[model samples]
Target: MSTVEACEAAQTCWFSCRAAALGGQTWTDGPLHWIREGAEQNLMFPTRIPADAVQSAVEEARETGVQIIGAWLGTEVDASALAAAGFERGWAPSWMAAPVADVGVSDDPRVELQEESNDYSDEYADYAEMLKLTRVRPQHTWYAAAYVEPGKAASRKLAGPRFAGRAWSHLTGETAGVFDMNVWPRFQRRGIGSGLLRAVVAAAAQAGARDAVLNATTEGRLLYETCGFRQIGAGITWWLHLEA
Candidate 1:
């Protein structure tokens, strides 16, 4: 698939998995596809929204009491309508992709990786704690975390997690989605990030995914690129706060 097509597929899979994990709702209206996780959260996908549809979506969000409405707008997508609807421009995140086979693996012995299939498990609690330390909300239900001690691999039952990430199954075509990757501030340069990434990407590939994709923060773009991900598309995030 072309990079743009791959990006779209990745996004669809990410949103679908997020909906499943969060008990969220999703719907498509005209050219707009809406994914809402709660009363306060809503996101529109594929950018390229027409002005009328943007206005309509905004009006609907207001009616439904959505506190935050987010959209990743393409370079060509008009920002005027969103701005008129009270949306403020935010950071641009890159949509990235890599072939499953091309993704690099980390064999760092100090980093021990663990996967959490149950959201309520203590392992997940550890993961959530790490996420909170990084100022990320623990919204997804499933995840994996990497841990380490001075001289040995950390045990889930004995030690706290230091970094967290997770991969979603391929929900749209053959593309798997990666989300919620974060490393603790002190562990920044350690191979913990790459180890966690490889573990999840390997899991997705084993589940029959041919390609892995994710949306990368500016700070994370280089790490992902070195691990075989390349930028396919870049988009600005627009946020509309109904309460404000």
Candidate 2:
């Protein structure tokens, strides 16, 4: 598969895990899969783009009466078509990947890494609070539960010392997708984030993954690059706000 296709598949798997954790239903119409969160909103992701299906997916999202609709268009999809459909292109995150040997390692003594337990722990709670503080999402507690629960079964959860930060790497076949890399505000600039990333990558490699992939935010572009991850493709998410 192409890098874009591989990245999209990995992302879809991660989203599926999150949706299952929340007991949400996933439905597919044509090439698109709608991961609906009750009536609050819907995540419309296209596994494969057929001609005109993108526009139909947008129409379906509007008909759902969802106040906000988020979609990630693969590199092969035409972004302008979605824009013409009234979906505003928001932050476009870069999809990056690197071979196991290229992933950098950290030798910082203060940075200790540990695997998370199946049941929730104090570290998980602190990590959720840290995500809330950094990302400014007060509802991250629910999101955290969705991520942590699925991760325990299908991914590796790596935590830094004193729960300063954490990251998750989910592997399927030979590709591993990294997600939920968060660091406490107080722990910023202390190499904890990098340390956690190194640990996660190492775990993926040891688990027999040939490569690792992640969608990097603007704030994390440099860090991922520093760790030998290079942009293989890009994805654009369009946000459509509907009338209540």
Candidate 3:
């Protein structure tokens, strides 16, 4: 195994948990990301961020000629800073899923969660899949990103090379967030959810993550609970269409 920690850092998919696989265009400033560009809308997704450091990100983007349609901040950040920079949220008020390490994972059998094997069989291909659950509707390109990020699974050289998905462990720091975990509907109820969850928990422990976080779905919440994972908070991510 390449080690889950190595995989997550190589990918920038920390807290997102592959939540929104939008084919978002991205620019990087060290670890900070400007996801989705070249449209009436672009997003500011900051990780390892300090509240006041956000506007500096906006200022940096301006130097590169990228027009920021809007920005998305986890509740821990101050949106007022973005307003000071001349942008306003175009959608409903937003919130974030809080990180909770104090909680534990559930050990239930209604589901078996495991790491995604990049194996694509017609049988597995037809499984019912739930990547991420969100309250906001997204722009077309964002939707495109979701369907594509899954293919990155093919990049792995695991035994079940046909599978495609993402996993993370927060060793030393925060773990790699589990983005989209699902069974092809044809493969559902076979403990696949639980299997994947177990794999992630093990991966996190190995990676030395302090804890893991995910923006779970209603159907998936039970799976997470069974794995000893508890909910700490919820988030609302927004997108604004601009005249690109």
Candidate 4:
């Protein structure tokens, strides 16, 4: 899938060019946004950045509620400068993909991967439980904050009596997508995760998405492989915070 398309599907994530959107004229929504007030030039040329230019964009983003959130690119130019410029390593999560309906899931009978049409708040409780149960996790606190905060990916909203985590599964046209799957310790290894993944594939098939996507972890890898998912690549992120 196109990185741009993936960004739209993922919501919180953005490609390198879209990262420039973070530097718009005004900032709103919340600190979780990737925008910076005067970072357009830097966005255009992330590499070979002038010392003052990089500093200016970083400072501008901080001055407003915008957080750098990091940048994404196809090349090492940005990563190299980001590292030398003091941008810390955000994450190096494994990017995996799977062909729809290729794997067998043993958890088919227990849980049902229904389309959660309700708001994220409705799914918040389940989503939170999933996060808590997620022992093998990404290497950062930012991801933890994501589900807790609204607008960020993994966020959930209240739906009627229960909370629902929304995603491409909720959107029109796109079906094959990943979600925050959670199973309590008491319910561990019972096939909930696999079932949910199956739900994703099923949902995608219904919507026309060719495959399911996710940033998988070590623990989830086996489960995913068992279900026919393959590792697409590794997602390496570089984060820079400009100190005034």
| Highest lDDT scorer | 1
Whose TM-score is greatest here? 1
lDDT of 1 by residue, 205-242 (tens): 66566887888998998888889998888777889778
Cα lDDT for residue 75, model 3? 55
Write model 2 residue lDDT over 50-162, tens digit each, in one string: 53765676666668665776778765665565567677878887989998678865565544444333334665553333332213222111111111112233334453224
lDDT winner, 3 or 4: 4
For all candidates in order, the CA lDDT equals 0.65, 0.64, 0.42, 0.44
- Give the per-residue lDDT of model 3 (tens digit) for 90-165: 4432111223333334344333232242334555442222222221233000110101122344445433322323
TM-score of 2: 0.68
TM-score of each: 0.75, 0.68, 0.43, 0.53
CA shift of 123, model 4, Å: 13
**Count of clashing pairs, candidate 3:** 55
Angstrom error at residue 214, model 2? 0.7
lDDT of 2 at 65: 62
Residue 43 C-alpha lDDT in model 4: 39
lDDT of 3: 0.42
Model 1: ten consecutive residues of lowest lDDT = 133-142
